[model samples]
Target: MQNRPDLPHSAINPQLVWTGFMAMCVGMFMAILDVQVVATSLPTIQSALDIDPDQMSWIQTAYLIAEVVAIPLTGFLTRFLTMRWLFVTSLTLFVIASAGCATSSSFGGLVSWRVLQGFSGGTLIPSVFSAVFILFPKERQAVATTVAGVLAVLAPTVGPIVGGWLTETYSWHWLFLINVLPGIAAALVALRSLPREDINTSELRNLDGLSLVLMAVSLASLELALKEAPTSGWISVYIVTLLCLSTASGCAFVWRSLHRTRPLVDLDNFRDRNFLTGSILSFVLGIGLFGSVYLMPVFLAFVRGHNALEIGMTMLVTGTAQLVTAPIAVALEKRVDARLLSAAGFTVFAIGIAMSGFQDPRSDYDAMFWPQVVRGAAIMFCLLPPTRLALGRLSPDKVPDASGLFNLMRNLGGAIGIALIDTIIYTRSEPIGRTLLARLQAGDTDAATFIGVPLQAIADHKGALDQKTMAMLDPLLQTAATVQALNEAWIVMAVLTGCAILCLPFARPVAPAE
Candidate 1:
């Protein structure tokens, strides 16, 4: 068979290749860091902006909802816009949004700006993957992915530490402002270094708009339902209605794609066993990943009475360990089947989660380190191989679509995981708190005897009791309940991680390298 001569030669300049790779890395770092940085800084933002707890979550939810909806459209959008144009536009939007976020005087304004940032940043992962694939040949693609992987993994891990420091020392605004410089640099480098490629307008015109709308609606509805389900009652009628609508919309999307000549996303890709299996694994991993990330800091802050900086420092260790192990995972990939490696990775992650389950309020930094080390190494193993296995067999033309779907599922999994953990914490915490309160009431005669100047007065007209006395008592009761709730949440996460380990057998072995 005659090979196509029109395709760019694999013998491109190494320096240019590195430059493009670094640009993609910079873009990814900006996107991911923005998300993680905000996690640690959320408290500061809440305090500065005087955000209610219920509304405070919108800061994260708005970004995720926008990002999720935008991700699936990457396949279609890339066909119309050149990579350079897309990267530059996205970076510009992200930078501007960051400025808006930093300067916003109200919580609503910050959330609105975050939505814009999410929309722009959503295009970044697919763009970076496409750029790396184009710059390197088949053999060296692993190396390229590894480099990108390191940045991708490290960004989220270090985001909290950086964000915490900035919020503690400077202000929460610095978290967003810090991205402006990197965003500008990435846009400039992308404009100068990325090679021009031929684009087919005919292909661009083939995009199915209806399917795009359906996908967006379905994902957005489902996310809204999940986010609210925790606090609004487990299966409220409103949630059920949204779930049904989301499901119907999703089905319609699949049905539409199957019939259309050039659907926004080809439904047939799911037929690939490896893709299907890898996607499932990715979803489960996402559950573990985001669930743990979200729960840990909250546990540290609310239960252990740690400040933002202390919590960030604890997480920083795991992030650093993951950074150190990323290259080693890549090297091992050369010699091992990705499936086996992934399974091993899941095992390590499960162990880490299990260890974390044992933590109490008194647990120190040393107690946290080993589990994080395991988790760091585990994530590198899980992230790289499954990604390779899922996309490796795809034809070059379908790679972009596959990447889009892959990332979308991962994000969806994260959303679901967060919802699940949040639900578990809420549902279980209350009952556990009540039980603890009852026990404390029964066990502490002194607490029971004081009565705090008559039960009726305390319950109805408590102005008589000193505010300082009430405040002091409130902390003791709250601390005990918080401890109980955190312990339950940790156990739930550990169990989920264990279930993820069982998914390894389902992953097909990577074919022997040629």
Candidate 2:
């Protein structure tokens, strides 16, 4: 075995390591939070920048595509540059990019800055995940993972509220400006505290340039294809071409990786049964986690006519529940079989998703509270176990690459899950709206009630309603249809999450790594 240059336990300083670890967590949190934050305030950004509605989605897509490409490259970068240098450099660039984003006056300028932000921010997740194993000993790893996992899931949960408050109180520029101070402080702390090792420059000389290109092409094209698939029909030539490019490039990258002694991404990580099953579970959890987050805001803003802050305030229940349950989850993780814990977590989470699926047009804060609580309470279990199952058995030197692949699964799952949710909403809403409209035309009072029109307004008029009255009701009908469509998307994700449990049996039991 090669003698990796990890810091020895005897030389460790408890205070500095903890400080550095916390700094890395902050950086990771900021990165993950930016996605949801921007999502919540995108309308404000679009209006302020005078961006066309058709081009508005590019702001999010460019960031995401850049992120997916950067994730798998973390392992190689870590090896070449060392964790400390990689993190500090990435965070510094991220902060600069955030500032750039805030000052941009045009759509192209904002998108360019966002791409830089995404690539830099994308490295933070796997870096923190890798730090867990590198920085902590066996007994402390579970606690470390629990802390990291809590923050990882918590950021997205709280993002909408944060974004909403900032947009309402200040302006859209504050959204990116918020990261500047904290990011700088984290970079300084990490530079001083994180362990340093001699850089391996030889890795750069041996780097497979072709494999790198193949991966970038595959991931970027796939992300673009997913972004367009809902708006453009799946059978459309542009989408089909992108999908083919992604598939062919992905296959070539995998083959080349397996053949190399030092591949950019370690494809061999998937050979471990526990890791493989855990990655699958991570992907499914992403669907439920990211999909649920996307579903709630849409339901609130469009269906219930809530503003950004109100949407955030209403969904705050989930983050509150997660915080309350963190200690209990941490305790259970130390005593429980991870597979069983994961199974229980996914089951409870599925129930939460399904509960929201049954909601009507009238569902509001009170109606959503318990479901959010259920899902939030289950989040730690969902994250902690799969993380341990996947990376626990790997060697010290291998953890970085393995961590990249592990984290990438969840992000990929999220991208695909959001795309699917949008497809269901876009294609099904018009048809569903027409059906409800037909029922109302036939004098079905139930349809009127579901669409939230007054009994007195439509009851006597019945089939003889005037054009003005019908026009007034059109928006309401459309909203109700969207709500139902959102519910269907929720149910689909719930079923997908529930089926993830059956795969749990395949994961080998994980004991804490030595």
Candidate 3:
């Protein structure tokens, strides 16, 4: 056979390459899907488990913290366990954890299972991207990456829709139960097909125990503070203590990573301008991506009085738009300037999210449609190209480390983003409550009318009805306040996204590697 160095390389067997690729995508889909799918049924789960509404946020927070903490260590885990064994172990652990979550009768038990699920599920995400760089030839990287990108965006997009239907029709347990079959099948396919690598136990010799400890503590405390900040008071003793400790630990973790020889994974990737720029975009992408997802469901279920099924069906619009844009994004990736694409993506996404800010109290399926479409179309351009900038053309040896760090930034951004928005919703509503109550106290008839307090009788029955008006008006006012807060949060996201344009110049185009 003639050797042609310039010709596209088919380095691995086609059957194994695609089978293993699809398997990873399935695992990625299942894991990402699990997070979003259960989001809608959270209220139902809280009710069923008899969990306190105050601590219910922990259900999502625990998983996010565990998942994010595991992300940067992916390079380490991949070194110790090949993609094949890692996926197998992670899939197995994920399946077991899902089953445990479904059957758990207590809050603690469910949360414990979720933590394990997060750690295992975390590995699957970066591994899918790592696989794209390592498994596919440069020529086909775009197509393969697009497939993974589609699943990543698609799963979350459909998650609530599927979750709402399942929870409304069957039970909340079905959210976790749905993962078992697919998880098992993905594991089986990956086990049979993925090419194996020898475990590199030598990579852990220095371990950097302090970095690992500090990393875990830092991430955990940060997530806790975010989750509790809204009600507990952002500057309260508990929130402040957690934030202070997290800051100390995070500073120490960075110091240890920079000074230590074999840091957990490379923090050095950020020194690269393109990598750093791409990372910042990824972080903002997380805020918009996870923030929008989190906000919409709450807005729909809580404010719009929509059921689980309706929220899910509406969310499907984002996913559907993503499908439409995937090919265009991939095509443009080759011909267009990457930094421009990123700028355009963030700009387009910001506009999309801003569209959501105009939502009314009566916002419904039709009202949310255009915003989801704009966001969905913009998702591909936001995700795929930055991925290339962050992970593309790296030394094969650096691929794992780069991918791990890259994905970690996005997830961490999401965890923090969720907390900020939660704080926004909690804090913003309280003032509105106080302000509205004051209006009533000042004998403002509009306040009474707003709450349907029969303003006609207010003057005559001022003494009797003042107390009654407060009681009647509280829930109605609270709901309005929440809608106002969500609108503010959407505007904030749009502004944050616009700021990503500042990071645009650093994400310069990387020419295709010959």
Q: Tens-digit lDDT track for model 1 on 1-514?
A: 0111134645556676678668867987889888988977776788999999878889988998899888777766666666666777788899999999989999888999999999999988877765555556656667777777777777766777788788878888899999898889888887777665545577557767788889988998999999999888757899999899999999999999998878888667788878887777778778778777777787777776787678778887777888788778877877788778877887788777777776555565787889788888788787777778788777766666777788888888888888887777777766755664454444444332322223443445323445664565455555555655665666676667667656566666785222
lDDT of 3 by residue, 1-514 (tens): 0111122346567788899889999999999998887777888999999999977877887788898888878887777777778889999999999999999999999999999999999899999998888787776788888999999888887888888888878999999999899899989999888876666567667577778899999988987887777768989999999999999999999988898777887888888888888889889999999899989988998887888788888888998899988988888877776778888999999999999997656688899999999999999989888888888857666677788888888877777787788888887888966775667666678765653455665666554545665577668778767877888899998999889889776565686422
Q: Output the TM-score of candidate 2.
A: 0.96
lDDT of 1 at 259: 86
As for TM-score, the candidate ahead, 1 or 2, is 2
TM-score of each candidate structure, all chains considered together: 0.88, 0.96, 0.90
User: Which candidate number maximizes lDDT?
Assistant: 2
Model 1 is weakest, by summed lDDT over 10 consecutive residues, at 445-454
Rank by TM-score (best first): 2, 3, 1
Question: How many residue pairs collide in each prediction?
Answer: 0, 0, 1
Regions more than 4 Å wrong, model 2: 1-7, 441-445, 454-469, 512-514
Looking at candidate 2, the ten consecutive residues that score lowest on lDDT are 1-10
Query: Which has the higher TM-score value, candidate number 2 or candidate number 3?
Result: 2
